[model samples]
Structure formats: structure tokens, C-alpha cells
Target: MKVKGYPMLASLLAVMLLVGLQTPAYGENATTRATWIWQTDLIKDGGEELLHFASDEGITLIYLQIDRQLPPEIYEAFIKRAHENQIAVHALGGDPRWALTEHREDMLGLADWVLNYNGKVSTGARFDGIHLDIEPYVLAQWEDETDEVISTWEQNLIMFLNQASGSDLELGIDIPFWFDRYTLGNGTSLNEWLIGTFDQVTVMAYRNQVESENGILDLTRDELELANRLGKQILIGVNTKEMPREPHTTFYGYGKESLNAKMEHLSSALGSYASFAGIAIHDIRNWQNMSSDVTVPPDEEEPTTPPPDPDPDPNPEPGEGDRVPDADPITRDPVVRGTYIWEAHEVIRNSQEILDFAKEKNLNWLYVRLDLEQPYTKYSSFVKQAAAAGIEVHALGGHPIWALEENRPRMMRLVNYVKNYNRAVEGDERFHGIHLDIEPYVLPAWRENSQQVISEWTANLDAFVTELKKDSNLEASMDMAVWLDKYKVTGQDMSLSKWMINRMDHVSLMAFRDKAEGSNGIIAVAKEEIAFADELGKPIKISVEIKASHEGDHITFYEEGAAYMEEELAKLPELLKDSPSFTGSLVHAYAYWKNAKP
Candidate 1:
């Protein structure tokens, strides 16, 4: 936040850093903390002054979004038992499909469910990573109609913040304290693609009901004086719960002990001329998950003579003209087609028998898993009430601390607890994309503790889908299936066609498994896994498995194996005609259209 020249962004800032992707081995611990978001839903609706402004006062980073999603061998032993009790896990990348409720691939499927669950809890450790709570560029009021799609997606979000830029994995951008009334800060393209790619931004600052015990809590000081006059690094946002706005028009939020005395009185009145780099509690909010008693110490010091490293040696390699650049033109957009049901939890809580079997069968996508070791807020409120009855969400759940493999600071605080699982509603402003049903595995008694958590979950799911396809306000993917050769015949050392081949646009391949018994024949195994995901050249999206486990008594799909898997799944136009590595097909469920709309 010390903006005098905002860290002197030397020359196009190393071509704005991040180009190819995959960073985050996580080690740094410089420590100047303060990133909390413990959603104590206003101390059970704002009572004990939001629990004495949260456990006796002075809060530090606590952010929580855990609804459900956990199975990578129980979230890698659940974030190494919460960093041996230090409590630093913050992932909350959401999906209520913002942009005033359009489909825009459900904001790129909620930036592919927060970059493959922030690449499976930043597979390693030494925590403190992401917090991008999907704020759909401000649901389109002005951000200049998406500022030329955010200046052509700020060169792939500076190559996904140069592979999610980091020291000990750090990146934040929960934005939307409404650009603090635009004093140039709002010329817009999502506020110059988030003040030109984030290293810090957290906002949603606070909304409506304006205050009460600490009632209408404040602190949007114009997006913290425009990220402290553009040195860009600030975190404010409010709302510990009671949302309302118009009808009941609530907003009177506070109570994690009144937003921790409103973030230590806005970091003691904006820490010494705005270097106050932390607060972000608008969500991960719910009061019961308390524990703050009082901490807020780090008053921003280290300047004894520090700040020198303009290019000091912290792994600064690239000089020989930094080669490996080209290939990211794929920019994730296989346009996410339909019908997906990895672990169909009681068929979406039987929402009218899965919307009368997806309107009688012409199914149109419904990939739901919603996990993080179960009891997920009633399946996250039944996939946000099945997207108000149209249906599209995809999550498939994970995180018992991502099977704690990389071990580095407990996998970067479990990649900020799965990137702050759906921060109440900016990206989830409701559903479409937020799926990374990531299914990594290896055997022979867990291959070397699952190869540093499966190569840190394949380089953190391709740097969380190249950092939410360069978050011009997120779009997403990564729902691979058909057990890619049974994860290489169970030895489980998969690169996944060179790690998500050309890094996602959309990918689906559950080519009817369990060794196609009496025949799920699987259209010649979905044309040999869509020609091995089109020989891994990338641009993928190939599906097939339209009817499984039927004959009642809990799944056996009888009627002659559901009529020969519906006549070999209607022979898929003679098994994908001239397969250009096809880009669609997803069934094996609303129970194979119970008789009409797909």
C-alpha cells in the first residue's frame, strides 16, 4: 500500500511477470500478517458485539470457506492438522455467476473452481496463498462494460500473475468495495485488470445498512484510498453475515467481535500513511468458527534498511531473454458443454427427482460433488438452490488439507483453505463454472507419499487454470474423468497428458469404467478417450457415459444394461465421426434423462 511509485514497477514489470505458469513450492515467511475473514455470521446475528469484535479483539488472517470438497486422501491429512494449530488457511474463490447474473460460463465456471482448488491446497505447505472471492467485475454498472474484456484479459492476467507469483505463495483480490466512487480509479477494465494484476486487493469493503453496536460498520475508505493511492495492496471489505439489502434491506453486519474492532480501527487509522495491508473479512464469515482472543501485532516494520531487492536474488532467473513463452493462446473456453455427475450426491438432493430427470432427459450439465470432507452446508444449499432451477454448477469436493504432501508450511495454509470457498456471493452471485473435480492418485501403498502430493497436484492444477484464466473476472474448467488409463494402471504417476495437456478450456472424460462389464461398450471407449485427449495437443472437451447404475435397488442399470447403454449411447454419430478430438458429451445421469430434456 505505500504507493509512491508502487514498488517502482521496473520496465513493463518483467513483461508483467508470470508467463508460462506453475510456481509455488512455497518457503518464504517474511511475516507482516493480518488477512482474517472468519464469517461468524455476525456473532449469531450480531449479539455480543460480534463476540467482542472477535475473540477479545486484534484479529489476524483466519479466512474460511469450507462448505465441502475433500477426498485427495482426506485433504492431504487435512492441511497438516491446520498448520500444527497456527490456523492459516484462506481459499474462498466463489461462484454465484456475477456479471448481473449471466452465464459467461458461470464466470468461467467460477474460475474453474478457484484454480483447481488453488491447485489442491498448494500441495506442499508453509501456508498463506490465495483469497480471490469472485466479484464479477462489479456486476456491470460501469467498469466500462468489462473494459474491453479487461484490456484483452491483461495478457492472460500477466501470465496468471506470473504463475501465481510468490515467496511463500501470496496473492489476494476479493475486490468490489465498488471502486470507491471512481476518481480515475474507475476508468475501468475491471479497474485496470485489478490495478494491474494482484499481489493484494481484497475489497467488497461493506454494503447497505451502513451500523449498530459497531452496527453499520464502515472502512471502504474509497477502496482503502484506492489501494493506498495505487501502490496497490490493501484489504478492507465487510459483512460478517446478515445480507438483505432491499426487501428486509439488512446490512447491519459486524460481530467477529465487531469486525475485530473494525480491523483494528482500520489498522490504527490506515497504518502510517497506508502501508496497512490487511483486513478482508466480508466472508468465509459465519460466527461460530471464532478463535481470535487477540493477536494483531505486526505493525509493519522490517524497514531497518530492507526494501532493496529490486532484482536481488530470490530465484530471479529469466535474464537470458526468458524463452518458454508462446502456447497460452488456448485461453480456456471449450465453452463447457453439459450433463456431468462425478459423484452425484443423492442426485442433487433429489431436487424434484433431479428436475424431473433433467426435464425428461435432454440433459445440460449438472456436475456436482460439493465436498471438503462432507457435511457441506446442505450441499452448499443444494448447489445454490439448483441455480434457481436451471442447473449447471460443478464442484465434486476436496480438502482434508490436500493430503498434506508438499509439506511446505502445511501446503500454504491449505491454499488459503481452498481459496476461500465461495465468499458468500460475488462470483457465485450464483452458478456455472467452479469445477476442478481433481482426482489424483498413486498406489503401491501411496507412491512416495503420493509424489509430493502428486507433483503438487500437477503443478497446482496448472497454476489454478492459469490463475482463473487471467481473472478478467474469472471463467473456469478441469473435470477430467475416465480414469486416464486408470491413472496409468494404478501405479499413479500421471502427468495427465503432460499435465492438463494444453492447460484446460474444458475437459471431461469418464469414459464408462468398471471395465465395461456387460457393455457400457462406451462408444469404443469414447473413441479411445477422445483420441487420447487429441494426442494432448490441448483444446479438449470430450464426454460419453450417458446412463449408468439404473435397475433400482441403488444402481445396476438393468433393462438390459439400460438398453445396451442406450444402444451404445446412440452410437455417438458412429463413434465421433471424424474426431477432431471432439468437444462434447456428458451423461451417465439426471439418471440418463428419466425420459426427456438434455
Candidate 2:
């Protein structure tokens, strides 16, 4: 549902005339409260719990994401119960890819399923409407082919409308508030056009504050005015889910009381308008778990004042517990032609083959996965061999859960294992560094409580470095996603990318796009990270994807072949000549690249 960047406008007057619409049955003077149920399995698995939560939250409308695989009877049973509780259910389904012509069938299929299911269901079980949450801006094409993307997106919506013609079901769409900034070819704002085209338009006016510049009210004002002028319902959508990257967009840490107060204020300010359909929280799961008080638990809600910040931990002296005297600082070539070795056991079984491949590829560094269960001699022999061949080998291991406080020991164990191994080895046989591949965003808790995950991830990094620097001069490096620049450290003005670059000896940005250049390519996405690293005088390597990805053909060099990948990668040196921090590039792994067509 989150789309990046700004958009242009469009006019939908002609389209509206072509397809007549019916307004949903919102009782006279009754404020329509709604929530999204994105997890469709809940309909069959936890129907009672879901219905009870909806009734308690006073949610009048539920936007249930359609799961076509589920039995039609499950939908009927759930919708019937929801109807009994006076809650109307609307089928919801969409993807950013739906904006493309080839993906139109997926969009139309949702509509056909809903209409077909409605025909066989009882009145109470019938879906009241269809809600589309397609966010085309998330597409790679949105950056370079804005016009074409918008045109296709509009065409897809028209196709959807044409498919739904003659149906009683109302149509609605979720759009960001900034759609008004995008002026369509016909000179109408996209927001206004959408408001005119659909039976209802839910403006994602997601902000913790309801007033002030860039707040919910300011962002939604134009859409509200347009909705009023067009005499269409405009449901203001607020977010309860955690958004660590854009913290101000959600009322996650603000508590339920604050959310209710802000919604009350919003209602007071815009309730007079006929088009004001009322507030819609982004979802039900998070809203249900939102605390009544910001800082205090529901059971212990007496505290009114915020807790004071804790004192910072002082730096520990070297040679403390499990710490040895610091080893002399090691230096290496600034250039980083690296690749990952995920199967460490391969090094033991095929040392010569791995070395021959690395040499052939001219790789200078290897992030070799450390198998702690194996004897020390297994890694020692490979590290010594790699070092003699002028290749730096670093230990690599991580998991998503390693980002949480409860899982700190698991992460520390890896750090300690490497540190202890270094203490017992000769300089040439020792690991050059530790390369972490922790992708905390993959954790389910990351979506539910992102701020907490970020905090714990940061703490784990601190523990990692502290343990790493205890007795060795090992370099600290990690693989990070390119988009992490969007997130700021909770209390810091700097971005997460900058913070990591400043802390680590060097970092590898997973700029997975196949192309080295162009708006949606690797260079464009890694630009910010490279700049940040340059500012901090740190080194950064742009990592490319070779492993076949289902995401899209543009995501990997799999189909392009190794020869073509090298040809594209050959463009980086000249293009990034000015960036001293641009050390070099790294292919995702040895396994995929080894067998990749030449």
C-alpha cells in the first residue's frame, strides 16, 4: 500500500459518465468507521476473534483482502456473521504489477471472483463493494517511465471498471494524499479524478498529527475539497501499524487515546462536509494491540509522565573479560571485487575449485559462511590458501531473529566464535573480518513493531562491534538494502545508511538491479549510500543479484548471462570515478555465478 515518490493528476469526468456508480448504504448522519483485514485466512481460522474485535472497535466496514483459494462457504459464513454485527465487508486485492498490461488479468480476476461469489451468496453474505490498493509508484518503471506507467495504471482501472459494469457493488481505491500534486494530461489532479471516478476514495492521510504543515489535515485538504465539490465520499485513512522508516506517518507509539482524540478533532473540523465519510484505520490487528497509554501497559496505566532517557554506556577498556590484547591494524586494497560463499563446507571439500574460480573471476574478497560445527582446521586451511592468493576471507552468518534483544546471544555467539578463532590462529590463517547478512525487515515482528526491531538491531550491532574489536583488528562490515536510506535513527538526524556507514569499516549495499545505469538501476539506487560513505570517508561496495529472482526480470542478471553482467558492470568504474567510497562491486554468491552461462 506504500508507494514512493510524487505523482501527476488526471480527469475522470468522461469515465464517470461511461460507468454509472451507486453510493454505498451509509446511514444518514452516521460516521462510517472502517478497517482493513489484509490477512484473509483469518476469515476461516479466527472468524469469531475477528468479528469480536471489529464490534469492539466499532468498525462498520471491513476491507477484507480476497483469498481466491479459500472455499466460498468460508467467505459466506464470515460475511454473514459480520453482517449480523452490522459490519459491511468489501473485497480487497491488488499489486503494483497490476498497472502493467500483462498483469491486468490478475486485477480483473479479483473483480470477477467477487461478482461471481456475490451471485451465489445470500444478501447478508454478499460483498458490499470492491477496494483496490494498487500502488503503481512502487514499480521500477515509475521512475523512468512515469507517463507510460500512469497511462497503463489508468487503463487498468478503466478495465476494472468495465468488468464491474452493471454490478451493484460500489468501487473504491486507496490513494496517497499527494496525488493532487500530479496534474493529469487533461489538467485535473489525480486525486480529484479518482474522487470523481470511484464511488469512494480513501485518502491515505497517514500522519500522527492531524494539524500543521505536512500533517494529516494539511495533506488531505485538497482531496477533501475536491470530494466535497464532486459530492463523493472521501474516507480519511490513518495508520496504526509501525513505520520505522517514516515514523511520523503512523500513530503507533502515540497510543489509542491520542488516536481517538486526533480523529475526534478531525471529525469536528471536517464533519460538516457531505463527502466526509469518516476515519478508517489502516488495519485491525495493530489497532487491537495499540496500548491505551503511550508508555504504560493497560494493566498499569497510572503513569502520566514519560520516562527519562537512560545514560549512555561508557566504552569498555580493551583486554577485559574474554578480550585479548589488540592486534595491529590490518590494511588491504581499497578496491573490493568480492563474492559470497554461502556453503562453507564447499571450501573443505573443493578448496582448489573455489580458489581457481575466485582467481579466474579476479575476486579480491570472499564472505565465506562459517560452519561453527566444523573443526578449526577446516577454515584455517582455506583462509591461509585464500590469503596466499591475495584474497581476503571474512566469516559470514546471520538470521532475521538475530536483530531482537531476545536473540542477541545467538548473534553474539557468532561474533565470539570468530573472535576466539582469530585469537587461536596465525595472521595469514585468521579471518580478515566478519560479514553480517542480517535482514531484520524479513521478520514478522518487523511489520508489527518496526521501531522495536530497529532499536534491537542497532543494539545488536553495538554488541557485535564491541565483541569484534575486543582483541582483533578485524574489519566490521555488513550487507544492507539500498532503501535503508529512507529510515532515520530514532533520535538522530542522520539516515540509517549514514549511521551504518559511519560505524562500519566498510558496507555492501544490496543494489540488486541488473543494470548498472538508468533511473531504476543499481547506480541510481546506490547513489545515496555511496555519497553518504564518501562523506564519512568509508568504503562501500555495490552488490548485484545473479540468483534468479521471481520478483522481476529487471531484478537479476540471471537471464542476461555472465558475459553480459560483466559488460554492464564494466560501466561502473568510469561512472563512479568521482566517488572515493565506491570501492568496487560484488556478485551475490559463488554458487549461482559459477554455473551462470558465460
Candidate 3:
């Protein structure tokens, strides 16, 4: 959390009254007071005592550190206890370094860890929400590469929110109170965008007084007003923990009596705002020990360096410096906003719903499968309808061992079907491309005959791409797991993932992780793939799943519902803003996406 600025006086009578005042309950008329439970307090076996203190103090929320080192049962019991007392327990942990690309996967790992835990824990015992404390301004590079670092900060933030959106988790971020002073090159004010993006925001309004220019309410006024207008919640945070410099930074110097007085004044002054959720004390342990005799150091000096230039050219052409200077962008902007359609025939009957969905979601591409059992006329009509709706239809089909000579005909059949459809139809009614989803990993031969099967799988993909290009004028693409880059064919040194991307006009990464953030999740898995595609100048779509799966909860958002899935997908374009080859995204299939329960 970020802190800036300070305040003045309180009478002994007000201090005495403040100390005796009870912590308000959590409700609209009452302040929803919360506090951070540092990891240290949690490590000690004080769960019962912690709840007692919070309940007595009227803490409605406790941002608990996600300590995997502690037993799962510990958190379960603690959360169970907290919930019983009406205090929401949110998983909280983050570091400034997470803004770096290399460290982002680990940062996202925190969310995945929480999600995985929630999957196994009982619903009631699970975390009520996720509260991230990622303060990117603390990084050393932030001073020199302010624009780049802050952009990375927002990227990571959006990714984390995307992951949290996969569950029913209410997400909150801790931002410095002064974020309004910082603006992005895109004209987005940090505080405004942050508050607007999340479910709620807790400003680090860590001053000790109530009414002067640097007072608690004064510092938090901007956020409270903005949140009210946006219908988002804002929590005015205060400091209790003692720091090295500026004793005014915490209440330790003046004691709990003074602190309570200031908090009371803050609540009274800011409580009228609809967005003013409540006050959140910096921590629990420090509040418990208000007897430190720490001396005040001289006022800390502010950095002399000015912040990065906020207004960069917003209309640079493609292949210019819009992205990192390391790679050049494609001549044409990417056009891969797509979804797979397994029930190609059913689409004809449900053409309007499909068209409406495509138009509403800005989906421009469709990967429709060949249902041989359905009439050829049905496929043609659906393709025509899709074209009319401004959706480019890509003929989709695949089978394992497609690289083998014996199975090569199966792949050819799909290519031929699309060719025939194109030959029969004129202009816009014809298929725009062919998309293959052959996965050799699922084949029985993969395990029974490892080397040969692996070798054959790569060979088949190579053959298919080579043959498809020669036989069809339509654009060709294929889907593969993100880890294909890490895998090498039995006798070959080349990466399967890279090889596939290089050979195709486009590649869709079956980035399948339900959570969009984190290392093992969607964004991290696709990071390398996107970079490689950027280098190769091929367009790519990072696909996600909404369908139910026998696979683990971490792999699909079946339980998260459609609204949440949409929220997560909306974060993608911004998250991948720097990747020139990022064409957009692809939902796994039309049938599943439409039917997924909200």
C-alpha cells in the first residue's frame, strides 16, 4: 500500500472519549472497520484471541496472509471462526517485484494457490475474497522507467483480477491515497482506473489526524468521491504500526487514545459519502501493542526525480514503438477474436443466438466443426449466417495421429470439405479458414509407443500444415497446449509449440487454465507463446475454457459462471497490449460458452 502526506491536534477529552468508544458494527449506517492481520500474528497459535480482539474492536474484515506453510485446517478453522463472528477473511499477500515480467508468474501463483485451496476447502471455510497489496512504485526501476514499470503494474493487476473473477471471490486492491496525482500516457488516472476496475479499493490513507490538509479524511476524499460516483466501495485506511521515520506516520507516538480520536473524526467526516465503506487499521499486532517509545527521525526526503511523461503519442502506427522495441509488429493488426463450435449443425437452428452473441462480444472468427451426419446444406446456411453477422467462419476438425500416413486422409477430409464448401459458395458465404485441434497427447499410442507416437505426432502436424498450405487458399491455423514449447520431439531438437506456430498462419494456445493470472495459469503459460509468435510475425489467439471438465477446477471455470468468465476475458486485451501478435482471444467452443451456467 502507498502512503503520502500528514495532519494536527486533538484534545485530551476527545482522546479519552475515543478510547472508550466501541468499534462500530459492519453495516450501511455503521462503519465497516477492518485491519490487516500480519503473517507473524497468524504464525502464532492465536486464532481464538485474534477473533476475540477483532470482534471486540468491530473489525468487519481481516486481510489474512496466505501462509501455505500453516496447515490448511488452521486457515479453515480460523476462517470458520471469523465468519461466525461476521468478519470477512480475505487471502492477502503480494510484493512490489511482481510487476516485473520475470516475477509475474510467481505473483499470479499466489492467486492460483488460493484458488486451489478453495477448490478443496468447504465453501464456508473458503476465503471470502482476495486482497492484493502489490505496490509497484517501490521497485528500484520505477524511478528510471516509470512509464514502463507502471504499465507493467497495471498489466499484472488486470491479470490478478482476471484470475480472481473466476470464482465468486470479491477482489480488493490496496493503493496509495495519492494515486490520483499519477496519470498514465493513455490519460487514465491511476486512482480512478484502479477503483473502477476492482470490486473495492482500500486507500492507504495512513495519516494520524482528521481535518488538516494532510488529515485522514482529506487524504481519502478523492477516492471516496470517485468510488461513490462509480458505485464502488472505498475503505479509508489508517496506520497503527510504528515506522523508522516520521513518528506522525503512526499512532504509536500519541498512543491509542489519540489514534481513536482521529479515527472517530475521520469516520464522522467521511461517513456521509456513499462510497466510504469504513476505516481499515494498518495492522493488528501494532494496535495490540501501543506502548512503543520510538523516537521520531528527521522528516524523510522526497525523491527529486519527476514522474515519467504521461502523454506519449497514442496513435503510433503498427510496427512502431507502441510495444517493446525488441520486436516489430505485423503489417496488419491481429484478427483472431474467435470461438470454437462443436455442434456445427445445431448452429443452423440457433443461428440468431449465435449471431447475437458474436456481435455483442465483438467476436470476428468462428471455428466450426464438420458434422458429417448433418446435411451439407445446414453447414452452408450457418456459415452464411455467420458471415452476415460479420463473423469469419473457419472450418474446424482434427484427430490424433494426423501426421501418420494412415491417418493423413482424415486430416485431408477436413481440408477437402472446406475446399468443396468454398468451391460451391460465392464470396462471403465460403469458409474463411481451417482450424485443426489434433492432440497427440490424448492418443492411446502416445503412452504405449512413446517415441514413435511423439515422433509421429510432430511429423503429422508438419505434414498437415505443409499439405494444407499447398491444397487450400484459405488461411490455416492449429491449437496446441502452451507447454508444447518445453517439449522436444523424440529425435528432434525443435520445440513442438514453436514449430507449430512457425508453420501456421495463426496458432491458438489452449491456455486452458481457469484462472487467467499467475505462472501456471493462462497468462504465464501463454507469455512465451505470444513472444515467439510476435517474433515469427504470426497472429495468435489465447483460448480459455468455460465448459465443464473432468479435469481439476484449476483447469476450467465451469463453476464460475458466464458473467465472471466474461469479466475475466475482458481483461485480456489490456493484459496483452504489448504483444503485437496477440490477435485477441478464443472461447473453447460455442455450445459450452452459451450453455455455461451463470
Top-TM-score candidate index? 2
lDDT of 3 by residue, 1-598 (tens): 1211111111321332242233232225645788998654453574888889898888899999877677787888888888889989888888888877778887788889889889998977999888988887756476458789877887777667556654777778899988898876577798887877777689997765566556666677788778766667778788875331233456543456556666776677765777777888988877876533222211222111212212322212223322333434476565557788776445766777888888877888888777654556777777777877778888887654354445666677777677777788767678878888765553334445646766766676677667767755888788877766655556655556666777788888988777777656677767777877887777888888876664567667777877877787777777888888888788877766765666
lDDT of 1 by residue, 378-480 (tens): 4556556566555566653332223223323323332333344454444432344555544433111123354555555656665565554442333356555
Residue runs of model 3 more than 4 Å from their true location after superposition: 1-30, 40-46, 291-598
TM-score of each: 0.32, 0.56, 0.45
Of candidate 1, the 10-residue stretch with the lowest lDDT total is 301-310
Report model 2's TM-score to 2 decimal places: 0.56
Task: Give the Cα lDDT of each candidate.
Answer: 0.43, 0.77, 0.70
Q: Mind sharing the TM-score for model 3?
A: 0.45
- lDDT score of model 3? 0.70
Sequence-dependent TM-score of model 1? 0.32
lDDT value, residue 351 of candidate 1? 59
How close to the true structure is residue 519 of candidate 1, measured as C-alpha lDDT? 34
